[model samples]
Target: MCIKEGLRLHSPVAAISRETTQDFDLGDRIAPEGTMVIMNIWMYHHMEKIWGPDHMEFKPERFSKENIDKMDHFQYVPFSAGPRNCIGQNFATNEEKIVLSKLLRNFTFRLDPDHKS
Candidate 1:
């Protein structure tokens, strides 16, 4: 039995645009005034240092108990961290699970010439 990669790829939000309502200090880092900050999700995920040597590989074993717990929660963030993270992130998870289950039950998948799974 085999499984096509899941959660190995990420499509980051093109921009991180948000409005500030109040003044707050994030530890030593300070965000002042009505600042509009933008972050590139793809760049962060693809960085060699953050994801390690085989960051580009689709290795499900990366999510194993020992490794998962050891990883930096703040850095391996497909979904940006904090209160302004993502509203629909939960829905995406549920949807992925359902799709995976259905795929598992219905057919055998392979990396064929017709289509790339």
Candidate 2:
């Protein structure tokens, strides 16, 4: 399964940048070969255009399989993307899932009545 929930809630990177391999027109702008471009992961993640009006809302159901294939790869990349995602992403994911499962099974958490986190 795709890491839809984990990625949407807690991304792994702040931003990413790369140089263009050749001259190209990005609609209204011209990007020359070797020109540098940066992706603001945080901004994009919360953008209305890319993620709808309630972008900041933690609605993992947005990534349901029915909707997953429709989204562009450029959006919502928590662990980086392509060939540069975290080298140990699989291991990390399993570890976190196991820990969370254990916590849920072993504990009864209660909010502090008089204390604020």
Candidate 3:
């Protein structure tokens, strides 16, 4: 849950560009063939409508089994999507978990003395 939430909040690939294979209609907009499309993942990650008012807050429980089913699969796509999705996503997520576990077990962290909330 924490891993998924972290990915949602800080997607490694915040934006991606794709060339249209064919002309497409996107509701209010139209894209001719060969058009370049830029997907802003970071913005989607923080959209209140999709993620709710606390989208910007780090709440790992949001990915809990009970809550996860309510969200759209594409709503938290840190690795982009479709055939072009990151190939290293699984490895990277696992690496993060291992590193985080080691860090938490070996050290303690606190806010800096001069830091302001």
Candidate 4:
């Protein structure tokens, strides 16, 4: 859940561009084949309609098993989505967890008095 929250708040790839493979109807309009589509994952992650007013808050429990199902499947995309999604996503997520766990277990951290939050 922490990892998912981190991704939602700070995705490595802020935006993605792709060419449509076929004519697609977006309801409001139709995009022809070969049309260039740019998706801003950062904006989506922060949208109040999708994530609520507290979207900017760092709340990992939102991804808990009991609450995860309430979210849209595409709402928390950090590695893009679909067939063109990042192949290294799983490995990267695992690596982040391992490194964070080790750091937490081996070190004691304190905020500096001069630091501003």
Candidate 5:
């Protein structure tokens, strides 16, 4: 949950581009076939409508089982979505969990008292 929230707040990939396989209807406009489409992942992740008024805030519980059902699968795509989604997403997530677990078990983190903002 924490990892997913972190990814949502600060996605590593800024955007993704895909060329339309067919003529696509964009509601307000129509993108003809073979047109390149770029999705602004960061902007999508921070939308107030999809993520609620607290979209900008980090709240992992939003991804909790109960609340997760209310969300659109495509809305949060830190690793992108659909058929062209990241191939290494599963490996990457598992690696992140292992690394975080190891770090927590081996280290203690604290802010420096002598450091000034």
Candidate 6:
């Protein structure tokens, strides 16, 4: 849950662009094939309507089993989604967990007041 929250708040890739393979309907209009679609993953992750008013805050509980179902499956895409997603995504996540576990087991971490993000 913590890792998922971290990814939600800070997705590695900010945006992605793809060329349309066919005419896509947008309800009011149609984007013909060959058009370039730019998806802003960062902006999508911070949507108030989907994530609530406190969207920007770091709250890991948002991914708790009880609350997780409230979200759309596609809303969280730190590695992008579908078949074209990063092949190393699973490996990377497992590696993160292992590294994080070792680090937490070995050290204590605290925010530095002098450093402002």
Which candidate tops lDDT?
5
Clashing pairs in 5: none
**How much is 68 displaced in model 6, in angstroms?**
2.0
Model 3 ranges with Cα > 4 A deviation: 110-115
| Pairs with backbone N, CA or C atoms under 3 Å apart (clashes), candidate 2 | none
lDDT string, candidate 5, 1-115, tens digits: 8999999999978999999989999999999999999999999999888888999898999889998888887888998899889999999999999999999999998989999
lDDT of 4 at 76: 81
Question: Candidate 4, residue 14: CA error in Å?
Answer: 1.3
Per-residue alpha-carbon lDDT of model 4 for 15-95, expressed as tens digits? 999999999899999999999999999998999998889989999998999888887778788899888899999999999
- lDDT by residue for model 1 (19-115), tens: 5556647689877768666667766666787777877778777777787789776655555668878788788777777988998899998777887
How would you encode candidate 3's per-residue C-alpha lDDT over 19-111 as one tens digit per residue? 999988999998999999998999989999988898899999998998888877677789988888999989998899999999999999987
Q: Which ten residues in a row have the lowest lDDT in candidate 5?
A: 67-76
Model 2 per-residue lDDT tens digits across residues 2-106: 356656655777888888999979999899999999987777677888888877776878888888789798676876789867788788788878888898899
Comparing candidate 3 with candidate 5, which one achieves the higher TM-score? Answer: 3
Q: Give candidate 2 misplaced runs (Cα > 4 Å).
A: 1-3, 110-117
Clashing pairs in 6: none
Ranking by TM-score: 3, 5, 4, 6, 2, 1
Candidate 5: stretches off by over 4 Å: 110-117
lDDT of 6 by residue, 12-78 (tens): 7788788999999979999999999988988999999888899999999999988878878788998
What overall lDDT, based on C-alpha atoms, would model 5 receive against the true structure? Answer: 0.92
Q: What's the TM for model 5? A: 0.87
Pairs of residues clashing in candidate 3 = none
Model 1: runs farther than 4 Å from truth?
Answer: 1-8, 18-33, 113-117
**Which ranges in model 6 have alpha carbons more than 4 Å from their true place?**
111-117
Candidate 4: lDDT of 28? Answer: 97
TM-score of 1: 0.69
